[model samples]
Target: MRAMTYDTYGGVEVLSETRIPVPKVGPGEVLVRVRCASVNPVDWKIMAGGLDGLMDVVYPVVPGWDVAGTVEYVGIDTPEFTAGDEVVAYARKDYVHGGTFAEFVTVPVRALAPKPASLTWQQAAGLPLAGLTAYQLLTRLDTGKEDTVLVHGAAGGVGSLGVQIARALGARVIGTASARNHDRLRELGCEPVEYGDGLAERVRALAPDGVTVVADFVGGVLDTTRAVLAEGGRHASIADHTVLGAGGQWMWVRPVGADLAELGRLADAGQLTVTVAKTFPLAELAAAFDLSREGHTAGKIVLEV
Candidate 1:
């Protein structure tokens, strides 16, 4: 199998393309013939040793968590899927080793979901991590039709999906982004607010009573969140652990097949979608990482395998 690997934690310069043996399927796992994989900031962060204390890593690491592919083989006792079934998954394992940035990846049955028929392979590749992040956060907050939600970093991968998911839940969404992405937010059924100076006022202008729920995808916005949250409002952050000190939850997405399936159902029902900002061939994994690190892409960056 052709895959990108890094021998040590560093930067993109350390990544190299090489041929390696196909990974073995264990019980409760399935081997996926990789069609596409999506790049998230965590991929590069893990590569650079940012998560050193959180998860163990093996050398010659293949880095990627989001996969959209076909099942080529299923392990003994894994009856949830079989050969030729299309699937998508947030395939983060307990340790960082074999990953989705290759010709094939072994996915646990717990993280596997049938691919949404309405999405292309590229779009499906992008949905797992970002969609799960938004879905979990909003549902944990119990976001509902009566609530007004504010989404920080509204045009990025997770926030973009956050906007759509909030809308699908019938909540009124106010998303913060640059003017360039404001129209895109509107198309996703969110009221767009520019994210610079006076962000709180901008949000307040949209909802005079302050927002009922806040989902912060971008870090460093706890103050703005405080300023715009209604009394008894719920809030959470995927990026900022500091949120834990402010009566909010610091969330990490879990790979649950049932949650991913619900996201797929939303996509199939035309209530959700993923935007592909750009894509690179499997060998260009480093370039994809560089683009995601720039922190300006409005949608998911993907790798076509």
Candidate 2:
């Protein structure tokens, strides 16, 4: 199989397309013939050694985690899915050589979910990590009813999903984005606020009582998660750990197949939607990485196998 990989962590220069052996199915695993792979910020972070503290990697690393494909074979013990099932999943636990950039990759059966019929392979490929992150932050935190929520980086993948999920759950959502994205955020059922020039004040103008929960997808110096959360309210970040030091307690996004399936249902029902800003062939994985690192993608970037 031809796959893209890097023998050392660095820039896109280190990435190369080469032939590698196809992965084999294990007792509890399924072999997926990958059709598309999605890029995430964590992909580049890991490539640059930014997440070495949390995840260790071997050389010639294959960095993709989000995969959309068909199950070509299922292990004897993997009864949840069978060959010919179309699936989408986050394959982080296969981190050592989770080669989503290849024609085939092996993942545990529990990680796979039936892909939504309404989404194309590229669109579904981008949903596993970002979509699941949004789902867990709101539903797992019990953020339903008339609660008010703030979403930082609302134009980005996870942030955009968080805004829509909050609104779907009957929450009043305030999302932070650039002036250009204000209209787009409004279309997603959110009150959009610019990221700078006193964001807290802008959100206050919308809901003076303060937001009950904050979902920060941008974990930089300007992250206003602490400022937006109501007193003693919950703050969750899908990005870096800056939110951990915020006044409110921080929550981490964990992958849950049940949660992802619920999100899939929303997508299939047209109650939830996602954007794919760009798609690259699997051989151009290096360029895909560069595009994701640019940090201004309108939606998720995908690599088609």
Best by lDDT: 1
**Which digits, one per residue and each the tens of the lDDT, describe model 1 over residues 1-305?**
99999999999999999999999999999999999999999999999999999999988899999999999999999989989999999999999999999999999999999999999999999999999999999999999999999999999999999999999999999999999998999999999999789989888888999999999999999999999999999999999999999999999999999999999999999999999999999989888988988989889999999
Error of 1 at 144 (Å): 0.8
| Candidate 1, position 164, lDDT | 95
- Model 2, residue 150: distance off in Å is 0.7
Candidate 1: which stretches are off by over 4 Å?
none
Model 2: per-residue Cα lDDT over 1-305, one tens digit each: 88888888788888888887877678989999999999988787778878777776777777788999999998879889989999998877735556588888888877788999999988999999999888887875688886888888889999898888888788988888999999999999998988777877888888777888877777763345555567767777665665566654355556566777888898997878889999999888888888888889989999989
For candidate 1, the TM-score is: 0.99
Clashes of each: 0, 0
What TM-score do all the candidates reach, one by one? 0.99, 0.94
Each prediction's whole-model lDDT (CA): 0.96, 0.82
